[model samples]
Target chain A: MSTLAFLGEFGEAIQFIFEGETTREGTQVGGSQFLELTVEHIKVSVVAMVVACALAIPLGLWLGHIRRGSFLAISLSNVGRAVPSLALIAFFVAYLGVGFTNVTLALVLLAIPPILTNAYVGVTQVHRETVDAARGMGMTEARIALRVELPLALPLIFGGIKTSAVNVIATATIAPLAGVTTLGDAIINVSGYGDVGRLAAAISVAALAVMTELTLGAAQRAVTPRGIRLESGRPSRRRTLSTRIGRTASP
Target chain B: MVASAVAALTAPLAQVQLRDRSGGDAGCVADDGLCPGWIADNFDRYVDPLVQHVYLVLASVAIGFAISFALALVAHRHRWMIAPIVQVTGILYTLPSIAVFFLLLPLTGRGSLTAIVALVAYSLLIIFRNITTGLDNVPEEARDAGRGMGLTDRQLLWRVELPLALPEIMAGLRIATTTTVGLATLAFFAGAGGLGGQIFADINFKSNVVVAGGLAVLLAAVLDAAILLAQRAITPWTRARAA
Candidate 1:
């Protein structure tokens, strides 16, 4: 339970990597360690998150900027929300077999909706007058969207990204079933070994998560455009009330 | 045609039920007859576990909502404090389920208590942020008018701001409910029970019917419906708006 003991397990793995004693499958001087499991999991999560960000960002921008197909994008994102990511991951495993590729695909699918929805909402929510002013100043539509609208929406978009990153990082623990190694490997493998290792790895992942949260949050705030507030400091009761009414009318 | 189609569809189902075990290979005992009974027994095994699963999610979400709502109210009054708290909660919200569960295991052990604590921590950020945002969105003029009319702080919150914020708060609850249901699946990994157990069983046994897959889908539907109903009941305003 001491920090030293906690670091002992994690640090040993690091030392193994540094000492070149660790094999791809995780056998070491002691033979047949769980390092490979750890590597596979880390790889699965990283690859999946990278892929998701790649696809989702562009789609989100389009949906956020274009405003026409925004509903389609938002709805797809909503459906993503509705269907549990774990179920989707399981389904992929069922259909595609347990492996890195399928697991990554599932995580990518899971990560997209938040990113896409947030980006789209962020851009769309950029004030109409701001867009008009930009246009009046003779900025091109693309230029306006990129320079003006994007900056305005950056905070919200980053907020979305922050949210997605947390989700992906946490859900990555489940990637083990798809034959991808992850932090969950320890939790699952060491369940019989007194759960100490499991607890240790869990703490490590949580630490990693807290670190990830702080880092991304700083990054989000950094990228988030400042000095833009809605003319109304708070969304008026009448406005929200009206929007609620409108939403109800359609549904 | 219908009979033949049904048989054809069931052929795959039968095959899945008969597959070899992947992880829990030791337990994949095959029975050529009584497939229905096999499925029934599989479900029966889960009765106790499934109850635990439902209990874990409901309890954690309820606790999380209460804590988050209280915090949100405090933040609402002290507007300057909202950002930091929201940011901090947002970070907590992002912690991986396994990570959070594992992190808490030292103190909580591998029990429902650990899972609930972790889940409640995760839920707090979302629920708190949403409630604060909802309450904040209540008109300042309305609040000022309430105060001008000699309404106390509590009176303003309950009679004015809370009602106005109900819709958004309910939306937050819906989001929290769905997220809790999904995350609760991880509880099985920790031995807390529920649809995850069924799904895990199916996964290990390679039986599609009993594999955590089918049962999870069913449980998800039920959870979704239950939350939707709860949302409707708590925010009768939502119904009023709809009507």
Candidate 2:
């Protein structure tokens, strides 16, 4: 198809997104619903991310502080990667009934493993010398973890959050399946949105996901303290070798 | 308890399957329960979709690896290129494949091509980062040894660095494979006939969803195990090392 034909009624599609349209089938779509769905999508993702962070971060930090359950944190991450988002959502919809809570619960499951694993890994990787010095300074365990280890581990912890944030937002596209019509309403109910409107919705979702990733990435950088920022020059071989050894030690 | 839960899950599906016109055993098929007989009899129906799914995963990963490997090699030689390449691929990675399907539809049109392109984009960041990190982590002593033997830069990279990097590279491939399998389930949106298409065709039917989704999950596990085994075979040194 020529560019012209391919973009057939593209202007109308944009209009349909901002100002609702009655399709040939006479179904109302786009317009204000787009804003509603977008808000809902963000709300669900934010809720899931908060819960995931609350549940995973402390556990990860405590476990990492104790330097135990390395196997649990790491393996949970690996198993989490193998589970497909669609199946998880479908299972929840099938068994638990569908709505904001069920979908948010499923997303929290999706979001947890990475944050948990990263938090654990990050704290464990904090320098032994640093931890010892803090202890030597008569710092309590909780104080040391919060003031020293937490700040040092913030970058990696944020790295995990960024990963989960993107995953959760992308997964939110299918929230419509659970009777929560996010932007996926346009994509799923194609007859209602029509082909052009579907394309518009897809573009919007893509934009949303990319924007989330970029924003979180910036936030991650901002939260990282200057002392821990990686220097421009590559580290010497000895430093890298130590990290390599650390990798082998972990599951 | 497990059986009861499965039964509960399947109950909703019975109504969905009731709408389906064709069935060999109307009673079992009608309820859309976990009808093993229906799946067993209709096993042939899954064959084509499974093949297509495999093709989608393999092709996307292969092409992704080829691109990433080449870029990693070039980026290794010019370290400055790494960050920009990563940023671009990272954006690509973050974009969900479902949205990608529709985004590419107007340009690439609907087919395996559209699905593969999105899948390939998603794989690039994972494989590229792994390869670059792997090369970076090759021990200084290994390079010195190669140089002492009068090996050129190319030979040292090929014989010393790349060999040492194999474990990490293969690990990236395994992750990429599993991820691609999960993502490819949505390829049906791009008109690529993967098991995802099968699942989405009658998503409410428990037996249908279970069989199709199970095959996908099974595929990921099998591929992951195969890669792990391959890693062991190729890097016997890793096996010899104490855990």
Candidate 3:
């Protein structure tokens, strides 16, 4: 096809995405509009991340504070890296039937390991001297964990959440496989929208992922304590997080 | 109660006996109705796709490693380039695999080429980050010593820097390889032909899903192990020091 023809098809698909349409045969499908699909994609990704954070953060914090179960945390992260997200979704869909809940659950499983590992690493990496000083000042274990460790660990915790957020958003593109309508609906159901639709959906998904990464990265930077911000001569937390994630995959 | 709930949910899906439209077998079973005998009978069908999947992974990782290594080297020398290069690759990495596959389809057409492009893009961030970090982590003392010994920059990099960086680089390669193996499964959506096509062909079939998915997992494990062994072989000092 000519480049102009391709662009015309792409423009038409974008129009279809904006202005909801009905088929010539009069079937009413309400899910493919760009705004609606974006909302669905965000909803699924946010819900999955929320669920992952709810489970992983507290557990990761407590485990890190206690400084035990390093083996478990490390192993879970490794296993998470090893398993394919598509396989997880397929397994859930096969057993649970297709729905938002099944996809969210699969994505939650996908998001957890990173958050957990990061939080664990974040807390554990807090200075030993700092913790000891807090203890010497008569702080309880819980108090020290909350007052001393949590604040210091916020950057890495946010890093983990940011990682999971980006991952969940990217993986959420497969939501259509589980009958949940997301941006992927355009690409997966090619008969419904054609090449234009696939390209547009791909564009939308990539934009969404980049947007999520930037937004969360800003949030991560914002949440870093002023003391740590002043310690910026150290390697930035973002690079550390990526390297940690990379290393954890192999170890 | 959970078991019954699962049974209730799955019962309806079982009735949908999706025919294999790809002309492999008309007698494919539904969800939960995996016929082991049928899987054994049709084992050969998976071999071609598995081989394709391996080729897809190897080609992508090889290309990705080369590009990432060069980029890492450039960024290492010119520190100003690292952030922009990382940002660009990070965005590429964050893009969904399915989206990338289809997006490239228009420009590259459907085949191994599109699949490799997408897979290579996905591998870059992991490999690039590791390579740069590995290079950066080379001890300043070691570099000074190499310079003191009158080693040329090229010789120093080849002999001292790259060797020391092997463990990290190998870690990156292992992650890239295993992750590529997983992502390659989705390349079937772009008509690239891999285990994903087989799994998608009979998504509800337990035998098909298990066999295809298992092979993908097995391939990941084997490749990971092979990389680990290669790392040990290349960095013999690491093991010797441990001993």
Tens digit of per-residue lDDT, candidate 3, span B35-57: 67677777887899899989999
* Interface RMSD (Å) of candidate 1: 11.1
Fraction of the true interface contacts (Cα pairs closer than 8 Å across chains) found in each model: 0.32, 0.36, 0.42
Best by DockQ: 3
Return the clash pairs for model 1, or none: A40-A181, A41-A181, A41-A182, A170-B96, B198-B212, B199-B212, B202-B211
Per-residue lDDT of candidate 1, residues A117-201 (tens digit)? 7777777777799899999999998898788977876766676666677777777777776677676666555422224345545
**Model 1, range B1-243, lDDT digits (tens) per residue?**
334324422332121123432222233344222144345445455566567767987899899998988787877778667668866776677678867766654345456787898789878876776676677678899999999999999999899889888767776766676677777777765546666655544553335433455555456567767766776777777677778
Residue-level lDDT tens digits of model 3 in A1-251: 45765466557656665664665567533334667889999999999998999999999999999999999987887777777777777777666778988899999999999899988988998889999999999999999988999999998888889878888888898788889989888766655654556677887887888888889889888988998887764766556555555554456
Separate DockQ for every predicted complex: 0.21, 0.27, 0.29
As a whole number from 0 to 100, the lDDT of residue A246 in candidate 2 is 32
Return the TM-score for candidate 1, rounded to 2 decimals.
0.77
With a 3 Å backbone cut-off (N, CA, C), the pairs that clash in candidate 3 are none
Give lDDT tens digits, candidate 2, residues A1-251: 46675566456667777887776677667888788888998999999999999999999999999999988999888778877888778767755767899999999999999899989888998899999999999999999999999998887898889889989988899888888888988887765666667777887888888898889889988988776665413565434533443352222
